[model samples]
Target chain A: GGIITQTPKFLIGQEGQKLTLKCQQNFNHDTMYWYRQDSGKGLRLIYYSITENDLQKGDLSEGYDASREKKSSFSLTVTSAQKNEMAVFLCASSIWDNYAEQFFGPGTRLTVL
Target chain B: GDQVEQSPSALSLHEGTSSALRCNFTTTTRSVQWFRQNSRGSLINLFYLASGTKENGRLKSAFDSKELYSTLHIRDAQLEDSGTYFCAAGNNAGAKLTFGGGTRLTVRP
Candidate 1:
């Protein structure tokens, strides 16, 4: 069984600061996704990639930028952190089709001060 | 306008009890997936159903595209079953999923 690993389990950022979160998967899946989850709420998709160097925007993609540098890694960048914001960012990977189950990372908790 | 409506925001159960969680989709969904997020915030995939029902161990899940609903049933609950459960639906083959609000389950001894 392959695992998805996310860097920086916790993050603290100031207003207007830029922060980046990274994800890696060894499942050799062709699809990767980024999602945001607020406290006590469901997850909203931000971006997804079908293949290396390919990107697609999701419902919550406006405030974020994503990069699929290669097949095994996907990264998300918060352009400008919002003040007093708190959320968790999750990464997932799937095997080239929607019918397959997606495996997720533990998540990175972001706190903006 | 959320695409998925999940019921029972929270639940508490004894170790030997049983219960079920559900998700209703607002649109036509091509597939449904169930996941349980543990205390450490790691999501573990439970089931992925395009249609019909699937069972594994003490858990069973069913999805009906025509009915636009899905259910996950857990019998003989254990302390390890305490976690937040979420159901996600996808309308197309794009692999983008709309997640339910989640049901936080607390199993007590």
Candidate 2:
């Protein structure tokens, strides 16, 4: 069994600051995803990568950028933090198969002050 | 756009009781996944199904692609089971999972 690791379990940044979250997976999955979950709500996908150097925008990708330089790692950058924003960013990975289950990391909680 | 709608935004159950949560899809879904978010904010994958039903211990899940719905049943609930559950639907391979609003389940003794 492989695990997904996300850095900086908690983050605090100023308004308009750029914060980056990193994720790495050893499952060798071909697909990686970034999702944001607001308090008391479900997750909304921000970006996903199907392969190395490939990216796909999701419903909530407007304020975020993603990079997938290595097959085992994916990173997300908050282009500009919004004031008083609080959310948890989750990273997940899965194989290319339609039936494959996506495994998630512990998540990074971000707070913009 | 494809959407996943989960019913009963919140639920309460007693120990040893049984309950079920459901998800209804707006479009044809090729697969469905169920996850439970623990208190520490970690998502635990419970079930992944393309079709039919699957049982593991006290939890059972069913997915009907033709019917565009899925259900998760919990038998003999426990305190550890109190958490937020989410169901995600996918139409294509390797990308784009539409998640439901989530069902918060609290198992009280």
Candidate 3:
């Protein structure tokens, strides 16, 4: 049994502001991922880390950046916020690189004013 | 880029009813996984299939590697089953998963 904790269940930001989201997992998983979900849309990959200090860009990584400072934690940063932007940021971790099941965080809902 | 598509973007069913959700892949995939998003915004893994079908309780899933598709079936629906369901395919080249738009399901009393 393991837990994936995401800080700040809700976040609010102003246009052009930078926002950061944090995720930590005690599973000691080797892979971590960041995904963004817009209203009425599917989840899009933003970033993924195979191991500590390793970063890979996803389809939606143009305006986002990610860091895996340690094996247990991964963070996502929004370079600039868009007005009225509302979405949920989801973090997931997997124990293996194969099509293994991923454990997800509770998620952080973000609103850009 | 690899692609995934879910059928019936939204669904509603009465208690005791049965339904199936499908995910189609644009390319041959290494594996597939199913998930259900709860009201609290937590994605819970329902099934992980490398190939063939697997069942647990009222849920069943099947993955076709060559055909590039997956299916999830729910029997005797319950209110607690209401929410969005997603299926993601893992690519063999790098093991990166590409997710579908998801299916929003509602089970009514």
Name the top lDDT candidate: 1
Per-model DockQ against the true two-chain complex: 0.80, 0.69, 0.67
Candidate 3 Cα RMSD after full superposition onto the native fold (Å) = 1.5
iRMS, candidate 2, in Å: value is 1.6
| Backbone clashes in model 2, listed as residue pairs | none
- Candidate 2 stretches with Cα past 4 Å from truth are none
| lDDT against true structure, model 2 | 0.93
lDDT of 2 by residue, A52-78 (tens): 999999889998999998999999999
Overall lDDT per candidate, in order of appearance: 0.94, 0.93, 0.90
Task: Report the CAPRI category for model 3.
Answer: medium
Tell me the lDDT of model 2 at B106: 98
lDDT of 3 by residue, B43-105 (tens): 898998889999999999999888888999999999999999999888764646788988999
Q: How displaced is residue A101 in candidate 3, in Å?
A: 2.2
Q: Each candidate's TM vs. the true structure? A: 0.97, 0.97, 0.95
lDDT for model 3 comes to: 0.90
Per-residue lDDT tens digits of candidate 3, residues A1-113?
89999988999999999999999999989999998988777777889999999998887899898999999999999999999999999999998666767778999999998
Clashing pairs in 3: none
Q: What would the per-residue lDDT of candidate 1 be over residues B1-109, giving only the tens digit for each residue? A: 8899998999999999999999999999999999999988888899999999999999999999999999999999999999999999988736788999999999999
Tell me the interface RMSD of every candidate, in Å: 1.2, 1.6, 1.6
Return the DockQ of model 1.
0.80
**Chain B only, TM-score of each candidate:** 0.97, 0.95, 0.95
